[model samples]
Target: MSFALYLAIMMTGDQIELVQESFAHVLPAAAGAAHTFYDRLFTLAPETRALFRGDIDDQGRKLFLTLAAVVDALDQLEKVVPVARALAIRHVGYGVEERHYSIVGVALIETLRGALGVRFNPETEAAWTSAYAILSGVMMSAANETASVKHVVAA
Candidate 1:
């Protein structure tokens, strides 16, 4: 959501190596992020909890693992556009909203800050903000496309 933060990452010259490094550093925080996000979601909209199956503990782990794996893949995606498009179609079933993404981004950043400790400087924050923007854009585009196609992916 921060334009300046996005600009910094956009201008940064680092390529695949930089993205891979960031993803590596993020693995430890991913699981905690899933917990935090679900906590907040349940707190804010308890009804949303009904959307999930009874077995949610494993769902939590799967959520984080999928995010970490998907992000790592994004860095090396020979065709990120198609992947995002497919994911968008899949996400339609969940009734995912653009606003929920902001919540996830918040928990994600907080988790990274926790894991990174003192290493989470302004530059790191900027990098994350930019990365989220790109990631969120993918979700948004996918949502729109899914709506048009009447396709859906389970959450």
Candidate 2:
């Protein structure tokens, strides 16, 4: 999809349906989707794979379990974002670069489409893409802002 089309959807506010569709139609797929996603993610970024301890497949299951727990408590994003932000800061220790976000996004979308099967229509696809964009942008910005503040404090 063109950037123009993405912007048009945002401008027209037609995406609320998409968002609702996600919370309704897609939430069930999230756990399986995330497991598959991290599999491909680790495969593509083998160096980062070492970040996981013990059995790789078990680690993937544990990951989806944690995310599912958080999704169940989505209303408590104050807790979620703080934990996420702290983990993002720790990504430095894992050698996760900002560029890895794109790879992660790709695996995520692929996993969603795979898990959703026939229900992953074009509109759903667009919505997922939009959601990922917003997620990635926010996460990267937060990480960057934290990094800047830390830099200033250290200096």
**Clashing pairs in model 1?**
90-153, 93-153
Give all TM-scores, in the order shown: 0.69, 0.64
Each prediction's whole-model lDDT (CA) = 0.63, 0.62
Stretches off by above 4 angstroms in model 2 are 1-32, 54-87, 153-155
In order, what is each prediction's RMSD in angstroms? Answer: 6.0, 6.1
Task: Give candidate 1 misplaced runs (Cα > 4 Å).
Answer: 1-19, 26-30, 41-48, 74-78, 151-155
CA shift at 117, candidate 2, in angstroms?
1.7
Model 2: how far residue 85 lies from native, Å: 3.9
Candidate 2 residues 47-84, lDDT tens each? Answer: 76766656765766665665454444333344445555
lDDT by residue (tens digit), candidate 1, 1-155: 44334433452545434445665776666666567767766776676687676467677787666666655654444344456556656666766666767766776677667667776766777767666766677677778866766545543
Model 2 steric clash pairs: none
Clash totals for all models, in order?
2, 0
TM for candidate 2 is 0.64
